[model samples]
Target chain A: MGDISKKDRIITAALKLFSENGYHKTTVSQIANQAEVAKGTVYWYFDSKKELFQAIILTGIQRLASKIENRIKEEDDIIEKIKLIVMIYLEFFDKGRQYFRMFQEGMLAVIDDNFKNKLMDFRTKQAEFIAKIIEQGKKEEKIRLDVDSKDMAYLLLTMLTSFNSHLHYDNDFNIISKKDTIINIFLQGISR
Target chain B: MGDISKKDRIITAALKLFSENGYHKTTVSQIANQAEVAKGTVYWYFDSKKELFQAIILTGIQRLASKIENRIKEEDDIIEKIKLIVMIYLEFFDKGRQYFRMFQEGMLAVIDDNFKNKLMDFRTKQAEFIAKIIEQGKKEEKIRLDVDSKDMAYLLLTMLTSFNSHLHYDNDFNIISKKDTIINIFLQGISR
Candidate 1:
């Protein structure tokens, strides 16, 4: 994890800067200073700010995907797998709220559009991977046969992406703040 | 439609400048020059750049929300209304993509957290309004009764926020990109 350690350090600094100053406003020098690494070291890990941010975006998404992948791999049943996916998703997000913050708010929006396109492509594959798993569940007849794998995959992703991960806000709505209850309502419906 | 005309012109100019030059880089004078409106006229319509951005965010959300509201308003069926909301949301995003593109990226991260706080509050109210509508649908027994109103509201809002109007991304093939398709997948689920 030597390279990973250095990469992670850079990412941590990048996150703070991005959140505090916006992605574009933050500079390589700032990240280098924060990382306590020399400018060349920063470039050694990431050649440019855009490339560094690309690393961050990919790292964030892949980290979540890896965690989910492992959790799903442990479960054999399709129903159990999906439920686990949802649960683990909220659980991991709860823990990695900063990553979620950056990911959701477009920390890399200042990066080139081509890079954004690549991130979306990465996301697409991740969704397809989930859809395929759901498809397997469908074949087992474990999930609803009529269910659309692709749509479910997309909905799950967008929903997951939308979760702000912060518990408190300017408002006082204790009713809408809990995660377990929120997940329950999502899987089912609120009406009678 | 003079007001509409003026508003449209301002929005158009703002969209291009904000997207390309960013919030700070793009100034009111720049906007006025581009819109071809007198600097005083720009100031008359908007007090300052901050107000202009607030206007941009508010107007964008209002435009999208109004479209969704109109589409779902006629439907008494909660499920149908939900579907329509999804559909109209996708279409609205398609129309306002440029506006969203402008504010959606690195700029929001740079803006004062207070501004975002207000915007997030606005989003909550918007979601609550939809939730109330769904709640009514539940009472009328036209919608499912299992999902929590708050969670459902959050779910819909998240989808809209994260999905860029729920329009299909080329990367996401698991779900239908169109409005009606997502609504169907959402209401019925993939389960046969």
Candidate 2:
């Protein structure tokens, strides 16, 4: 805490508080207190709680995308890369369950247009990241050429989100088996 | 409105307001006004706004389940039944977009334990409905026997939800083609 800047400390404190208490319940004063700063200092960094939340979401998206990119940088097999991406997503969300809650809140709540657009941009960026991988697979002759990469990317991301929700809500879900199930179903249809 | 009972009128009014202005913004007075009922009448039928919202959600789940059951009653092919189930879900949510929004709200918001349990029940009921169809498919030797019906059912439902969100948010999505894509991807692997 001492080494890091006040802004980073504020973000760290806010993330913990937000995840624990939720968006509406959390207050800037609490965040400032948790970050060991004054309320005025907190406002100096962020205009409002909503803007602070937006920053967290947007930063989270970028961090996740880069983490996925970094993890799969060396994997040559496209199928394995896809599987890695799924696993990383599951693990990432499992750890940062707050982001998932915030995402649902952002999507469903009557938020302003600017925040909504940021969310949209997050989705598009994520899809594009996966779509690029699918395109690479096509180039490598590993993936079928008939399917639309962009559409497939979106569907895959959606499935991952669904699995994430299950992981959070359903206590009986076995993550290891479920990971295999997702990869298998994605690569091979369920049809006999 | 005249044909329905007072309870039904209140439910209808509540759903519309909840969907239009969201759950927190809507008030009992507004609901009574919309339903053309006295405020006491609304209170007589429902103890509180939260209870009214819960009733709406529970009724919606039952209605959707029965609708899917009726639509696929005559479809003999298990695979075709599954397809019809997907189509019906898309159509149902498309028409009653409010339900989808409410679902998101219910899942993410820090609501009461009973409401959360009801939501879990709604999800389980939906999955079980599809799992029954998959079981039938397995008995008919149409779907692979190795895959767990319940898990597959959950996955299929998740995919449908992903598509529903897309339908509501993404203006560029082509429903006709997207339906075929989901069916195709589910029925056949993306791999050639």
Q: If scored against the real structure, what TM-score would every candidate get?
A: 0.77, 0.87
| Cα shift from native, residue B171, model 2 (Å) | 3.9
lDDT string for model 1 (B1-192, tens) is 336566567767877888565565677788888888887877777767777777777777776667666666678766666767776666666665555555545344445677767777777878788889778877887666766776667666665655662222333432334455456545553111
Error of 1 at A102 (Å): 2.7
- Among these predictions, the greatest lDDT belongs to 2
Say which candidate scores most in TM-score. Answer: 2
Candidate 1 on A45-150: residue-level lDDT in tens?
A: 7777767776776767777778887777888876667667777777766665555555434442444678668667777887898898878876775556555677
Give the CAPRI rating of model 1. Answer: acceptable
Show model 1 residue runs off by greater than 4 Å: A1-9, A38-41, A104-121, A164-192, B1-8, B19-33, B37-48, B66-73, B106-121, B165-177, B189-192
Question: Where does the lowest 10-residue lDDT sum fall in candidate 2 chain B?
Answer: B162-171
Shift in Å, residue A161, candidate 2: 3.3
